[model samples]
Target: MRQRIILDVDTGVDDSLALLYLLASPDAEIAGIASTAGNVPAAQVAINNLAWLELARAPEIEVALGAADPLEIPLRTTEDTHGPHGVGYAELPTPIRRISTRSAAQMWVDLVRRHPGELVGLCTGPLTNLALALREEPDLPRLLRRLVIMGGAFNHPGNTTPTTEWNIHVDPEAAKVVFDAFSFAPPDRRPIVCALDITESIEMRPTHLIRLAERAGSHPIETVSPADPPEARSVASNPIIRHLTDAVRFYFDFHDGYDLGYLAHMHDPFAAAVALDPALARTRPATVDIELEGALTRATTVADWAGIWGRPPNADIVVGTDPVRFFDRMIARIGDHARALYPGQPVGDPVTRLR
Candidate 1:
């Protein structure tokens, strides 16, 4: 049974990677994509989403635009992290199709309502769209089969701030709303948070990129200009892998600044993987709260790991992952997709085969 899923994203580098991973997964079926404001503005996020779908040749997936700003705070975009256009060095052709007429919040409500207990909600951005959906449909927590989110930093230092992760930090108010809403639901139905503790464990190095490129065969990277015709833009050599390679180079450079070496953590992809197969990571139940008033700890996710809070566990927080097996699955799925795209080309083995 293919897992039905709706992806909500800010369309940054890692978010784009997550989209590709889903497109490749045989067990997952993307119902739609909802663009939100996080790593970039909602409009740019929509543009990135449309361009990616076009590049993937996935015209069936519809995209809808969400919030332009957080519930209370002004929108903050991380163009420094993801290049000016959200995707790094690689420039995607202008999308021929427009976004869905329905807003992201409306799409979320409609899809879940239509699918009932079959929809899995995967969010890789700020919680604004989900929060808004909850406002429209209060029973959203119970309606979803599961909600997998890529955010929060429990016991580890954050990439955005000392206390808060980027997604939660961008809109703590919306995070608070989501956490509070889910607290009232059953533990099994609550959100499965792929926090930094687990996501930061899986890293992709240059060797992995080389393996991906090799699987894509010896295709020359071509740059498309605005004057180029649609067919010319579409016939690029291994466009998906080439774009991924080009964008990841920027991310690798960013990680180098933090002395994290030449590898970048597979944050969003791990979340998407866990969503497809819950057994990929080990999770523990915990009561999560977003700090709203702390001067230094605002937006921080407070997990009651030791039951000090005395409140029942409201969320399942990922704590562990087998990096080797995870990478194997990732590489295999990517290799499979690359082979499907270029059937005549011989795709060599991935960096590592599934164990």
Candidate 2:
């Protein structure tokens, strides 16, 4: 049976790729998508989700809008990291599909109850929506088949503050609630935490984009460079290739600006892959908690890796993975799916497709 999943995203550039990764994978069956506040505002995130589904011509999937703000703190969005609208330089068309009437929290609660013991929850954004859902349905931790979260920095340099990751930093209270609630989960069902320590290693350089475009048989195979004008857009023949190229290019530029290099971290998509196939991750079981009271370390993920806490491990923290294998899988699946959607030059002679 295909693994069933509900994705909660902030629709950041990486989050957009995560959605595409799930759609491209034959083994995944996306039940719904929740748009939460983080990379951009919740409303804009919902719009991006709808726009992407339309652009991909994907099967109809419910897109639910999450709370306008975080659980406690004021909403914080990183438009500089992601573009103004969260999707970087990609300008996807507005979708005709309407957002679901159910709020993101309601949608989460409803879907998990409907597919108890079968629905996998994947959160590539803040834990706001899931925390709200947990409040509505206290048994969610037991009902979910599994949960994979892309947040935290755990032993790695923080992407937000000196010690906090973006997702957790945005809503530490929500993150705390999630970690505390899932403590009772069985060993097999503990949340798989894909923190920055591992995700930073899943970097996507400009060459990876070229490989993806070429794999999809898109003509004028793309090349992104640090010297390219920031306003330059992709002209790849395939629509998917064009948008992804544009999006990843912006991400590349963002990283380079921070002296991190001209490559983007595939954080969300890596977590998405582990959600479907846990074997993709190498995890270390730990009692995980959020630092809510720290003056300078608030929102930091605290992993008791040495059993000093005397509490059961609530999270299986990913510490290692082979990034090369992941990029290979990403290129193959997304490339094939894109080619199928917009058939381009055949295997060798990159031409154009006309229905």
Candidate 3:
């Protein structure tokens, strides 16, 4: 059975991979994509979504524009971390497809209502759009079959701040609204939280990229390094491999700059995998909440694992996963899909849109 899913993302480099992962998965059906402001502006996010879909030769999927800013605070984007356009050095062709006339919030409400208990929600960006959708349809937590969120940092040092994760830090108010609203969901349906604690461990090294390219049957099996010149880009033989090489190369550069080695913490794609098969991750039930008032801990995610507050668990926080298993699965699916799309390909053909 194909699982129907709606992806809400900021389209960061990792988010791009997550989208491609879903596109490659045989049993996953992308119902729609919501572009939220985070890694870049909402407009560019929407463009990234369309461009990726076009690159993957995927079926027409509805793309919707989300709010320009968060619920309360001004928008904050991580261009330095994800590159100016959110896709690193890879230049995707402009998509001919247009966005849906409806807003992202409306799209969520309509999709869930239309599918009832058949839809699964996957969010890989700030909670802004989901927060907005909740305002119009408060019963969203009950309508969907499951929800998987790639945000928050529990017991892990924050990547954005000493105590905050990037997505939640972008809009703490929106995060709070989402966590609180979903508190009413049934325990079995608690949102699966893929916090930084587990996601940062799903690292993507240069070797993994090489494996992916090799599996795709792309010639020259590209490899990258921190010692390489900053301006270097991929000149791989396959179009998808070339683009992915360039995109992830930028990510590798960013991590090396932070002394985290030339590897990327693939946060979103892991969440996408968990959305497809929860067995990919081991989770713990917890009463999750967002911190909005702390001067040093604002946007921090606090999980009460021991029922200290006596509240029902609103989230199933991911705690463990075998990184090897995930990397193998990713390489197999994406590499096979790319090979089928552009078998024995040459260097990226003068970038152009599909007819």
Return the top candidate by TM-score: 2
> After best superposition, candidate 3 residue 254: deviation in angstroms?
0.7
Q: Estimate the lDDT of model 2.
A: 0.92
For 221-324, candidate 2 gives per-residue lDDT tens digits of 76888888867888888899899988888899999999999999999999999999999989999999998887999999999999998999999999889999
lDDT of 1 at 313: 82
Candidate 1 shows a clash count of 0
Segments of candidate 2 deviating more than 4 angstroms: 346-355
lDDT of 1 by residue, 34-84 (tens): 999999899999999999888877748889999899999998888888878
| lDDT against true structure, model 3 | 0.91
Task: Indicate whether candidate 2 or candidate 3 has the larger lDDT.
Answer: 2
Displacement of the residue 35 alpha carbon in candidate 1, Å: 0.1
Error of 3 at 157 (Å): 0.7
Task: Name the best candidate (by lDDT).
Answer: 2
Q: Decide which is better by lDDT, 1 or 2.
A: 2
Q: Write the per-residue lDDT of candidate 3 for residues 1-355, one digit (tens) a residue.
A: 8899999999989999999999999999999999999999999999999999998899999999999999998999999999999999888998999999999999999999998899999999998999999999999999999999999999999999998999999999999999999899988778999999999999999989888887887766667887667577676666788889888989989998999988999999999999999999999999999888898999999999999999999999999999999999999999999999988654333332111
Q: What TM-score do all the candidates reach, one by one?
A: 0.91, 0.97, 0.96
The local distance difference test score of each candidate is 0.83, 0.92, 0.91
